[model samples]
Target: MAGLAAAALLGTAFASTDGLARTGIFGSPGLTENDTSEWLNTGAPDFREVVESLRPSDLPLPAGRSWQPVIDQQVADGQREPARMQATGVHAAFAHYAVCVWDGEWLAARQAGDTARVGRAVEVIRGVPSWPIFVENDGGGTVDWLRSIAEAATHGDEGPIRQHIRANCTSSWIGVDQ
Candidate 1:
């Protein structure tokens, strides 16, 4: 899936920026960082059952540029639905990774102390997502906002944010470390 692929890319591609990558402030991936093998094996059965039970092709991506606001309002309202939280690995697990990677890129650009790169990266990463509004404590506010949008879009009971980013914002994957 595009979301999984994006997550994998974040895990490996932007290793420098990903705080989870030792270089990043987040530390590193724990024991479950092997690959998709585990997630696939476990999720396949349930996902198959869900597929068999639910109708296919029911999902539709949100209209152009509108989703960003809705997501923002939701966040501003402080609505973080735990039920909607991490339901799907693609949305939850992978989305988180992607944001982390993006954040790492943003911070590196900032830390490199390159004002121009930081500005460019901020612009690029910010535009990558529909709802660009995440609370990134890493100093890269725009990048953090974009990352938040990814997480919300993926985790929210809505369209495939992961797919959208993969298709439209591949360049956003370029972390500072990459």
Candidate 2:
């Protein structure tokens, strides 16, 4: 009975919503170093610069609201096929950066006991489809670590949450290894 209950919980946790699978739990196949190098050769932006530019307020929410509409609009504009081909690597790097920001926000909110901010941060995290892709693209084990941070935040466990961020968030940006 305990095993069955655990399985049910896992199912619910991993289930896809709106056709998008929840990320950070299961490890997807990672990209090879060669693949990353080739992608970078396509003129990707500097990973550090991209990471530095990201702010938590730049993420969009479900209710037609965003902290920075102009930045979001720029992202939206890059979704075209031509732009996508050129900027795929850059976008992936940004995804990793976003996760790091969200993880920090979640931790801060948890420490402050700010439930509203916590929920908002988690919502932004859930909306990011890049986590899974990051894992799939050989980003790093930090992808799973980020998921663990999310789970810890949900359970109000600050210890592990802080530990994971300290251990993984600093170097979590995709393409950083390259």
Best by TM-score: 2
Tens-place lDDT digits, model 1, residues 17-115: 222111212223465342222222111213333222222222222112122322232233222221111112323332333444444444565557766
lDDT of 2 by residue, 1-178 (tens): 1121121112111222222111222312253221321111111233223323543444453332333433343344332211211123434434544555566676666667888988987776655534444445443444555566566666766665455445544443211221
Cα error, residue 104 of model 1, in Å, equals 1.5
Model 1 steric clash total: 4
- Name the runs in model 1 displaced over 4 angstroms: 1-87, 128-178
Per-model lDDT: 0.33, 0.41
Counting only residues 3 or more apart in sequence or on different chains, how many pairs clash (N, Cα, C under 3 Å) in candidate 2?
3
Candidate 2 residues lying further than 4 Å off, grouped into runs, are 1-89, 126-132, 138-143, 170-178
Candidate 1 root-mean-square deviation in Å: 17.6
